[model samples]
Target: MSTFQLPSSTATTSTAYSSDEEDTLPYPGELSRSDFLAKDFNPEAYLSSLGRNRHQTLEDLRSDLRSRSQLLNQELLELVNGNYEEFLSLGADLHEGEERVEGVRVGVMGFGREVGGVGKVVREREREMEGLLVEKRRIGGEVGVGRALLEVDARLGEMEEGLGIIDRDEDEGDGFDEDDEEVGGEKGSSPVLRRLQRHTREFLLLTRMVERVGSSHPFLLAQQGRVDAIRKTLLLDLAAALRQAKAAKEADAMLGIVRMFSDLGAEGEGVRVLRGS
Candidate 1:
């Protein structure tokens, strides 16, 4: 084969591989570059810098990942601690519930589980309620009786007032002139006599009530006695006034006077009028 000769340089030349030439050499893989700029391109050094950049990025990523993982672990630990504290509280509450259940069991055993005692207590309470109802009824009856007595007392007061007015009118007069008394009695005696008759009837009604309730209320019996005395005094005074008024044909007064005498059991005085003398 004929050898091919390259052109010789005029100055000294190095036979060693230049950095640019080494960069241009075919690597293990199919890669190439411009031989003129291969020294400046420096592919190996560029690749080393790229590898360093990749490693530095990987290291920084790993450090950040480690710090994040540490934070996650701390959060997990706190969550676990919180859950553990809740678990402990729940355990204590469960223990208290168990104690309360045990106490209930002890109480049940102490009472011998007798339901009869509870029933007996309920029955006694019912009986006490019944007694209270009975007392309430008794009080209601007493209140009714008291109201009736009060009405009777009011009527008696009206009668007393009328009698007081009559007494005052009689006292103010000079004396009982038979003619004047006859004229006045014909006009005025109707009212007084009617009032007296009404009082007598009312007194009889009151006496009956007093007789019925007097044992329970002793004061009512005393009141009845006073009423009876007043009735007798009023009848005697009214009879005397009528006898004086009868001379001038005071028929109504004479009739009322006779009725009062009969009520007082003074039959002798009542007989004098019945004979028309």
Candidate 2:
């Protein structure tokens, strides 16, 4: 083996790499090459993505609004329909009650005397009054129906206003051009609109009917009152006859008068005839 000269430790230190070599390595805090490349990404592409997101959000909002609108409309319709039924029922009840009262009035009139003939006349008048009252009640019912129709119309208007707000929002999102105009114009004649229109027309007709009938009822009631007054007068006359007479003949005459008045009051035939007029 040939003996070689050993390198000294001082020589190895003298050939050391510079600090610049350390600078070439990436630091833990520094960005990677990929991160730097991604820094100048396209803003337009990002914005387009955001726009898509917004579109989806708007669509969701519209769907929610439409659902809410439908629910509200259904509830409103039910309420209006219920109100109409209640009013109609009330009016019928009133009519029936009035009829019963008139009958009772006639019965009371019949218990009087006949000698004066006043009792008979009063009973006839009461019968006429009952008929007039019936006619009046019928007319009143018509008026109530008309009022119910008007209420429904008013509710429809309110729902339309709410729908308008949603329409405005949609218009803002999608520019309303000629196509939109065409759609809107045609929508007015759609099946749903047609149905609503039919309902409105029916309501209007009912209202008009009520107005016509209402005008006649008060007059009829006035006539009825006159007949009632006559009945009351006859009742008074019979009562007087009952009190004044001691003789059986006088009592018999009074009884005949009472019977005549009772017959007249039976079903308010006179009142019915007046009402028919």
Candidate 3:
């Protein structure tokens, strides 16, 4: 029902009221909506506050309440009518709320699966990259080994070539120095024998390194025969040079040659040559 107000108490002229309409008589400007707004509002108490002035009969009050209720009902009906289309739309959407929620759930699940698949692919790629890195390191190590072996082989070849060149020069001159011991000066090495000393020392050191790698190392093993040939050729050259120095009576040259033998790890061979000479 629509809200109404009761008037406040004030001076009012007395008019004897019919018992049936005792508190229902009207008093002009004495009622307002604020009268009913009190926290403890009561219709009987509000009517009694009017004192002797009567407004109307009890049946009239009942009639006013009925009218207010009908008016409120009419207003509520109008409100519902005003947004009738929106109310229908809301009802329809609510009816389909479950299906919409299910669709959203399915979409989320599919996205999650895709994300998981991408993560799996990324992990697989990471593993592949790790394997590639390991392979790269192995290849790099092998390349380094190849370079070392190449260096060793090249050095050996150069030394062998030098030996041949020196041998050719040996028959060309006396190949002696002022330090030659044949003239009775203090013993000292000639230039020709000094070259041989260097050759023996370097070759022996290189060979020792190769041997330490183990005879079973495939690359060095394959080069073993060549290494042995170089060693044999070098020893022969040393022996011939020793013989030539003794024939020339060059003790200093011979001393240097024997030292070369020791450097080549062939001191036993030098001892035998000395015995024979």
**TM-scores of all models?**
0.40, 0.19, 0.47
Better of 2 and 3 by lDDT: 3
In lDDT terms, which candidate is top?
Answer: 3
Q: Which residue pairs show backbone clashes in model 1?
A: 20-38, 20-39
RMSD (Å) of each candidate, 1 decimal: 16.9, 46.2, 12.3
Tens-digit per-residue lDDT, 1-277, candidate 2: 9887557775565445445566575433311234324767664674464455443454654565477568769988999999989989999998999999999877777644443388678888999999999999988987775665455445333333332312334434322232232321334233333322232333344335435545355543343443344344444443444334323335444344344335444334322322342
lDDT, candidate 1, 151-233, per-residue tens: 66665555555455224444454233333433323345554555555555655666566666563575565566557666766
Cα RMSD (Å) between model 1 and the true structure?
Answer: 16.9
- Candidate 3 Cα lDDT to native: 0.72
In model 3, the worst 10-residue window by lDDT is 8-17
Q: Highest TM-score, which number? A: 3
Give the least accurate 10-residue stretch of model 2, judged by summed lDDT: 175-184
Using TM-score as the yardstick, the better of models 1 and 3 is 3
Question: How many steric clashes does model 2 contain?
Answer: 7
